[model samples]
Target: MQDYRNESEQFDRIVSIGMFEHVGHKNYREYMNVANRCLKDDGLFLLHTIGKT
Candidate 1:
C-alpha cells in the first residue's frame, strides 16, 4: 500500500479521540509532525486521551 504521509492535501481539522495512547511516547514527535504537516495553517487539531491516577 502507498504511504499516506506523502499525500499533498492538508486537512482543515484533525481529531484524535482514544487514539493518542496507541501512538506511544517514542513516536509522539513523529506523530505530531505528521499532524502538523497534514493540517492547514488555520486548521484545528484536537486530541482526546484517557488519564489514570
Candidate 2:
C-alpha cells in the first residue's frame, strides 16, 4: 500500500468515510502516510468517522 501511494500520487482530493475504526492505533501511521502521499500539494482531504457512547 505504501509503495502504491508513493508511486501514484494520483489523487487530487481524498474522501474517506466510515473507515477509521478498523484501523488500530498501531497502524495509524500507515494510514496517515497513505493519505499524505495520495494527496496532491494543496489538495483536500476529508475524513468522517462515527463515535459511539
Candidate 3:
C-alpha cells in the first residue's frame, strides 16, 4: 500500500463526511491511524456517516 502521510501537511482539523461506511470495520482502525498521522497534536477529527434503521 502507498504511504499517503507524506503527501500532505499535517492538519489542524480533519473532516470525513459520508466516507467511513466505505472504509468498513476491518480497516476502520487503519483509517483512524492514518487520520491521526495526518493530524497535528490537539487536532480535531470529525466523522459523519449514515446509520441503518
Q: What are the RMSD figures for all models against the true structure?
A: 2.5, 3.3, 3.3
* Model 2, residue 11: C-alpha shift (Å): 0.9
The number of the candidate with the highest TM-score is 1
Writing each residue's lDDT as its tens digit, candidate 3 over 9-48 gives 7899999898789878898898888898889999999989
Error of 2 at 43 (Å): 0.6
Which pairs clash in model 2?
none
C-alpha local distance difference test of each model = 0.82, 0.75, 0.82
Q: How many pairs of residues collide in model 1?
A: 0
**lDDT score of model 2?**
0.75
Report the poorest 10 consecutive residues by lDDT, candidate 2.
1-10
Candidate 2 structure quality by residue, lDDT tens digits, 1-53: 34433455558888878776677668778877888887889899898888787
Worst 10 residues of 3 by lDDT: 1-10
